[model samples]
Target: MRVKKQKRNRRTVKFFSACFGFREPFKVICDGTFIHHLLAHRLLPADDALAKLLGARVTLFSSRCITAELKSLGQSHSESLEASLQLIPASCDHEKRVNAAACIESIIAEGNGKHFFVATQDIELRRRLREVPSVPVIYGLKNSLLIEQPSTAQREFVKCSEEKRLHASVSEIQILRKEVNETDQGRDSFDPDQSSRTRTLKRSLDSTEKSKFKRKRAKGPNPLSCKKKKSKEVSIPSPNKEGSVPAKKRKRTRKKKDSGLEQGSGS
Candidate 1:
């Protein structure tokens, strides 16, 4: 149960931190009733308990009006008065002391620009604080401290602020329209003389470029396309046999019939 409560408190703190720009070492303004409750409940060393509840280091604050209210409670709240006195004094600037609730309300005003966390046991004060945007309220439940969830007014304020950021304002729209008109006027105001001068300059540049390069002239057909000339073959004569002496012919001799023919005659 304690873990759940702590988680809920942390989530609330994160919501304020992200949307409302609550920074580290938070400033908490404690009223008389809250101080008395802390002492009565033995929630001593107020800073440490509140710091743990806030999930960040905290600087406890008490206005002069709150201290005076605690002091008027006689000896029963002397200890609470001392505790309130020990806290850092928030600027009330009140020449005459007012009720603690009234003083705190004046400090917060409509928007909590200083980003103060109000710790009070007064139900009316807590209800009133809910109407103001970006003001986080802290109150004690039994021995535990809890931070209030953002009220509907605060949520609506956040939504409205976000929408304002997403869209442009009338002044910004007017400025943009003026800029577009100026650009359009600049484009519409064309000078004929300037255009004629530019055209002449361009013509001159073209003529100069044309003169720098020579146009290609007609040429003969490619040598590769024409037929190649055939080389002449000169006839080389061999030695004449009629002018030279002829070689002599060799005569062959035949062998005579032997004893085979004589033996045939005798048979």
Candidate 2:
């Protein structure tokens, strides 16, 4: 009976252990924003509470972008009061930073002698940290901490890209197949030049339908040409009519009475 009771107790302990994460608190990879926000919001007491729970001073890494962005507002040293932090410079380039982060996590592991938690605003970094078999990543979400395994897919960021492509070419091909299957005869009468020719044909057909025939009157010869012909005929004058004699005007009339009287008296 004691042996059975001992086995049950062991099972119960294992169940509770699996359900609870960071029950006594552990390590962290701290994000600057998370820490600074705690400071700005006057959550310094909470920071002390967390640090006490973890049994160590919080660690900070230098992300140049994060620092430059925050430095614009003159808040580079904003988290000084939260906990004693160590700044390790970080890279924005993913592969470069992942290796760097892995190195840091490994070093911290040696000092702490176990998997210390990683805190960051970068999901990609979190995933990379998770892949390390020794260094499990612990993330700060809102007010709590979540520990999870790394993602297999690495991440990249693109800004305002027109060439963003996916491996989803198969879906496009599937859509084409569905349309083509619906009408196999669509290819038979397919006219590639149809759009270009349509406007030209429409214009020509409209002109032909609207055209009307008109029989025009022939134009007469110009008046100046007729006047010129008359002037030429006048220049070539005919025989003069005044010089010619009529037959009746040609014969002479004698003094017949006077001659008759003298002949009669002489006789």
Candidate 3:
């Protein structure tokens, strides 16, 4: 049983601490059995596992199924179990174990390990939760409670995975930006008229080449060319040629007459 003075003293300290902005408390999802065990064994004050590790006390949470189980316990255990239920700061009203697991999984998934813990004695549940990286478990050891620190490798793995994801996202953004810039450049330099003119010029060149090839093929040696005879050129004389004077004789006679006239004049 808690003394009234101690309770009042705690309340006073809490009230003052709240006003002064005290340290944040760790968040712990717990089962009813662990709570009853701590209270019954008078070990709650001495355990201090979370405080030692986190430098702060914890705010407890549980599922409604745990609360119901505590309520249904025999009368012999009712008072202590009831007191334990009251000690929990919040209870998730989901009835199934799966629901509780799901809720705790989400909290762990946040990757804020220093602020969250899971307290339970269920062996199967502990095994399953341990599979999640960086999840700490608090369970009973001997007459006191202890916190099982998360595996170092698990923490490192989670850190590396997060870094890889961030790198991949950043690289993806860079690639997308590069693509967008290239697209913008292409658009800025594009000329529709130039492209169309280029296509027309190419078509004309191709047509000219095709026509040249067809002409060469047609001009190739024909089969009849080998059998054809060559034609000879023949000159024909004119009928009026008998009365025409020769060009050389006319020049000689004109030169002789000029010479005779010069002699007669001289004489």
On TM-score, the candidate that comes out on top is 1
Question: Global lDDT of each model?
Answer: 0.91, 0.48, 0.61
Residue 97 displacement (Å), model 1: 0.9
lDDT of 2 by residue, 22-66 (tens): 223444545555456455556556446345433445443445444
What is every candidate's alpha-carbon RMSD to the true fold?
13.7, 27.5, 26.7
Estimated TM-score for each candidate: 0.71, 0.29, 0.47
Best-matching candidate per lDDT: 1
Clashes of each: 0, 1, 0
| Worst window of 10 by summed lDDT in candidate 1 | 238-247
Where model 1 places Cα greater than 4 Å from the true spot, the runs are: 191-267
Model 1 has an lDDT value of 0.91
Pairs in steric clash, model 3: none
Arranged by lDDT with the best first, the candidates are 1, 3, 2
Cα RMSD, model 3: 26.7
**Which is superior by TM-score, 2 or 3?**
3
